[model samples]
Target chain A: QKEVEQDPGPLSVPEGAIVSLNCTYSNSAFQYFMWYRQYSRKGPELLMYTYSSGNKEDGRFTAQVDKSSKYISLFIRDSQPSDSATYLCGKNTGNQFYFGTGTSLTVIP
Target chain B: NAGVTQTPKFRILKIGQSMTLQCTQDMNHNYMYWYRQDPGMGLKLIYYSVGAGITDKGEVPNGYNVSRSTTEDFPLRLELAAPSQTSVYFCASILAGGGIQYFGAGTRLSVL
Candidate 1:
């Protein structure tokens, strides 16, 4: 199995809708989980960062990690058109870093 | 200060040509990394450096080379470009071990 797997979704949601992006990992040693947002031609920007399993909230974004299920998720509340972008999930296990194929999101007006 | 900067926002290189993608950080970060992103694919690490004079290969380092002579600069070198190497390259820096990595705008490279 791939170390990390994420649905390559062009998930479309209406503005003001709640958006949830998720990723699963096969590696159990992953200790740090991160969410990154990338615009059309720009590099990935660090959006949400969490040290371990649990939840972290920053403004309208929230990141959740479940080490038990080896899963991670990013939640966007009251999404806007500006939130349209690719969301990438990253896991760091000290030895190596793995990334999931990002999910493309579009917030429709 | 420019958190992290990459030169030549875009470039097109013919096969067998060579070029260097420059990455520099003003935050004096010790951990620097080079990653490439393909369409529909997430970023893949090419190379990483923990500090000056120290470097290591990441997942996808076969076609790339890197050197960290200073704390702020970690440049990725493409000796002989191949079409497979075409992708958007990004440079990122972290505080020490790892955390929120600051990224540059990215260099869109096309190897024809």
Candidate 2:
């Protein structure tokens, strides 16, 4: 089984909707969790980062990590069309990074 | 600062062709990695190096090779390219003291 699993979603939502993206992992050793956004033809850019567990808020983006469940989530409040992109969740083992198959989100205006 | 830079933003390779994907980092980081993202699939680590002259393979290393001869450069080599190798590649670097990684603009490669 892959270390990390996420739905490859092309989920479409209307503007001003709340978007939730998640990933589950099997490795408890993962210490760093990250959410990266990638537009077409562009490299993935780090959007939110968190260590271990608990919730972290940054502007309209919030990242939550539940280490006990080996799950992580990214929530976008007041979504906009400019937020349309592929969201990937990554975890670090202190050696290499494991990424989830990205979820493609389209926030239509 | 140019955190990380990858050459040949786009390329098309014929079967059995060999090429190098060049990556350079100006951050003077100690850890560098190469990953490839396939359609509907997550990015898979191809190789990584902790420092100069030290390299290790990740989950998927077949048909690919890598070298870290200098602190600033980590290049990935593909020998006998196959259609299955077509995907977007990214280079990232991180400081050993911190987990945050800086990535380069990806290289889109198509093997026909």
Candidate 3:
């Protein structure tokens, strides 16, 4: 099984809607969870990260991690067209990092 | 600070060709990594270095080599590029105790 698993979503939602992107991991050793946003033809950029199991809020985005279930989530509020991009969930096991296939989100305006 | 910079934004090479993808960071990060991203495959780590002169293989290390002679530079060498190697390559770095992993703009490579 892949270390990290995420839905390859081409999820489309209307503007001002709430969006939730999720990922699950098989490795319990992963202590750090991260969310990255990538635009077309560009590299992924760090959006937010949380250590262990907890919730972190950054403006309109919130990152939640449940270490017990090895699940991670990113919530976007008031989604806008500019929020349309691919979101990737990543897990870090100290020296190495693993990423999911990413979920493609498009906020229709 | 130029966070992370990668060279040869785009390249097309015939099978069996060899090339080096350069990555440099001005942040002086202690850890550097090389990853390849194919459509729907996400990012597959190729190699990583904890610090200068120390390199280790990641999940996908075949056909690739890396060196870290300085804290600011980590370059990936692709020898005998295969058609399967065609993908977008990304270089990333982070500080010693762990924090954010800054990524470069990525190199789009096509091996035909």
Candidate 4:
């Protein structure tokens, strides 16, 4: 199994809707989970970072990790058109880093 | 500060041609990495360096070479480019302890 797995979704949602992105992993050693947002033709930028289990909130974005299920999620509240981008999930286990195929999101007007 | 910068924002190289993708960081970070993004694929590590004069291969390093002679620069060299090597390359740096990586815009390379 791949160390990390994410649905490469072209998820379409209306503005002000809540957007949820998720990832699952088979590697239990992964302790650091990160979410990245990438616009068309640009490199990804870190959106949310979570260490170990639990949740972290930054502005309108929230990241949650459940080590028990090896699942991680990013929640975007009141999404906007500006939030349209590909979301990538990454897991770090010391020296090795693994990333999931990003999910493409489009917030309709 | 530029945080992290990648040069040759875009390039098209013929197969078997050689080229280098340059990456530099002004954050004085010790951990630098090279990653390539393909259509519908997540970023794949090509190479990484912990510090100057130290380098290691990541998951996809077969067609790439890298050297870290200074903390600010970590360039990936493609000796014999292949069509399979065409992708958007990104450079990233982190503060080792925090593990929050900052990425450059990217170098879009096309090997024809």
Candidate 5:
């Protein structure tokens, strides 16, 4: 089984909607979680980073990690068209980093 | 800073052809990685290096090789490439002990 699993979603939402992307992991040893955004033909960039299990807020993006369930989520409030991109969940499992298949999101104007 | 930079934005090779994916970073990061992303699939690590002259294989390291001869460059080599080897390649670097990585613009490769 893959270390990290995410909904490969081309989730389309209207502008001003709240978007929620999620990923689940099987490795309990994973202590660091991250969210990366990749535009078309571009490399993935770190968007939100969180360590352990907690909530972190940054502008329109919020990242939550629940170590108990091995689940993590990224919430975007007041979404915009510029926010359309693929969102990948990353886990730092000490030995190496694992990434999800990435959820594709499209915010329509 | 240039962060991570990958050469040859796109390439097409015939089966059995060999090529090198060049990666360079100006951040002087200690950790460098090579990953390939397939459609609808997550990026898979092919190889990685912790420092100069030190390299390790990740989850998928078949028909591929890497060398870290210098602190600024980590290049991945594909020998006798196959059609299945076609994918978008990404190069990323991270600071010592830091999980946050900076990635290059990526190289789209195809094996016909």
Candidate 6:
């Protein structure tokens, strides 16, 4: 099984909608989970990261991790057109990093 | 400061041609990595270096070579390019004990 798995979603949502992106991992050893946002033709940038579990919030974005289920999620409170990009979820074992297939999202105006 | 920089923002290569994707970081990071992103596939690791003079293969390392002569630079060399090698390449790095990865602007390569 792949280390990380995510839905390759072209999820379309209206502006101000709540957006939820999720990922699951097979490696129980994975601890640090991260979410990245990538615009077209640009590189992925770190959006949020969580060390073990629980939730971390920054502005309109919140990252949640459940080590027990090996699941990670990113929730956007109020989606915006600027949030239209590919979201990638990943986990790092300090040395090696594994990323998911990414979910493409478009916030309609 | 330029956190991480990749050269040749875009390139086109003929089959069997060779090229190198350059990656440099100014953050003095000890860990550097090379990854390839495909259409529906996420970023796949090609190569990574824990520190200067130490390199290791990641998930996808075929048809590629890498060398880390210094902590500031890590370049990936494609000895013989193929159509399967056409993809967007990204270089990333993080501090020795940090979990966050800083990525370059990326290099888009097309093999014809």
Residue-pair clashes per candidate: 0, 0, 0, 0, 0, 0
As a whole number from 0 to 100, the lDDT of residue A2 in candidate 5 is: 86
Tens-digit lDDT string for candidate 1 (B1-112): 8899999899999999999999999998989999999987788889998899999999899989999999989999999999999999999999877567889999999999
**What residue pairs are clashing in model 3?**
none
Q: What docking grade does candidate 1 earn? A: medium
Tens digits of per-residue lDDT for model 5, B7-98: 99999999999999999999989999999999998899999899999999999999999999999999999989999999999999998755
For candidate 1, the share of real interface contacts preserved is 0.72
- Candidate 1: lDDT of A35? 89
**Which of 5 and 6 is ahead in DockQ?**
6
Q: Of 2 and 6, which scores higher on lDDT?
A: 6
User: After superposing candidate 4, which stretches have Cα over 4 Å from the reference?
Assistant: none
True contacts kept of each: 0.72, 0.72, 0.81, 0.74, 0.70, 0.81
* Clashing pairs in model 6, backbone N/Cα/C closer than 3 A: none
Q: Give the TM-score of chain A, superposed on the true chain A, for all candidates in the order listed.
A: 0.95, 0.97, 0.96, 0.96, 0.96, 0.97
**Candidate 1 chain B lowest-lDDT run of ten:** B93-102
- Angstrom error at residue A39, model 4: 0.9
Compared with the true structure, all predictions reach lDDT values of 0.90, 0.92, 0.93, 0.91, 0.93, 0.94
Interface RMS for model 6: 1.1
DockQ of prediction 4: 0.74
lDDT of 3 by residue, A20-77 (tens): 9999999676367899999999989999987867889999999998888888999999
Give the range of the ten consecutive residues with the poorest summed lDDT in model 2 chain A.
Answer: A25-34
Top DockQ hit:
3
Q: Candidate 1: TM of chain A?
A: 0.95
Candidate 6 CAPRI classification by DockQ: high
Q: What DockQ do the predictions score, one after another?
A: 0.73, 0.74, 0.83, 0.74, 0.77, 0.81
* Candidate 6 DockQ vs. native: 0.81
lDDT of 6 by residue, B42-61 (tens): 99999999999999999999
Chain B TM-score (each prediction, in order): 0.98, 0.97, 0.97, 0.97, 0.97, 0.98
Candidate 5 regions exceeding 4 Å error are none
What lDDT tens digits, residue by residue, belong to model 1 across residues A45-74?
Answer: 889888777899999999998888888999
Residue A42 lDDT, candidate 5, scale 0-100: 95
Best first by DockQ, ranked = 3, 6, 5, 4, 2, 1
